[model samples]
Target: MKQRLIILSDLCGSEKSDWLIYYTHILNQKYDLVYYDSCQLGNVDTSSNDQQIIHQQFVEGGIRKAISQLIELEQNPIKILAFSIGGLIAWRYGLLTGNIKSLICISSTRLRKEVYKPKGEIELYFGEKDAYRPPMEWFINQNVKFEVIPNKHHEIYTEREFAEEFSLKLCNIQSH
Candidate 1:
């Protein structure tokens, strides 16, 4: 069976995008990858912008709702490749279900705010220039695996090849 992988939204999240579809096509050779953008997961106002979606997710019950939806969609253990706020959501779910095989989160700054260690092997990637990045000692102290990518926040995963390659490596996944 193909390994199951779930990707959550960024701060400026989207449930779907041409970019995501294109990337997943490349990844599908090895895993069953699912991408959920903000628009698809919540009871979002159709007109809401990225900022509004991000606010609704953290401020309201958006995070919890997303978890519930994920559980309903797949009961078996899965892997996660998430970004920003989506990383936060994926982190929460990993802790909640303990079914996460591997979790890879990029630029998830808010993770510094909360504290819940999940069962999965997780690796966090951050741009050296992102102010939100936690200190290196913190990861060492917490025993969390992480790395500092070359670029700043916006540019960290800008290159499609880099994003795709790095994400797969983090999960120890190989695509056909």
Candidate 2:
């Protein structure tokens, strides 16, 4: 049987324009890839609530719910690949659930706080031009492994080739 791999999209739900297709394609070759859209996972009321609050609640609550569902699924040794704010959610889930084997976070921050601790191997990728680079002190203090791509941003994984390579790396890691 193929290993279970969970791919969390950006704050928005699955859109044809996003990197979901690329990552799913790569993992489909060797694993049972599951796509979780962050938007649909939580209660988002952007009409009246402050945008930041909506986003915060969405990330934190959505992650908690996702972790609960994953635990119920009883999939052993799950790996998570998350994008943008979804990465922060994954980090929080790792801290709370302790079920993730490895996590790949792309262009994500806001996980520097003490509340969000990663319990699994974390590979953080940020664009050199990303505006939201967490301070080096944060990574140093948290002891997280990170990498900076040459030119990209929150939507870097939209590129098919990059997503494929990233998914392959995750698969390889999962195999070991």
Cα lDDT of candidate 1 equals: 0.70
Off by over 4 Å in 2: 45-77, 114-116, 173-176
RMSD of each: 3.1, 4.2
Q: lDDT by residue for model 1 over 55-128, one digit each (tens)?
A: 66555877777667766765777788887777777777777788788888888877877656778788888988
What is the TM-score of each predicted model, taking all chains together? 0.81, 0.78
Model 1 ranges off by over 4 Å = 50-53, 167-176
lDDT of each: 0.70, 0.69
The positional error of residue 7 in candidate 2, measured at the CA in angstroms, is 1.1
Error of 2 at 19 (Å): 2.7
Q: Can you write out model 2's per-residue Cα lDDT over 94-143, one digit (the tens) per residue?
A: 76668679888887755655445657788888877777777678878778
What alpha-carbon RMSD in Å does predicted model 2 have with respect to the real structure? 4.2
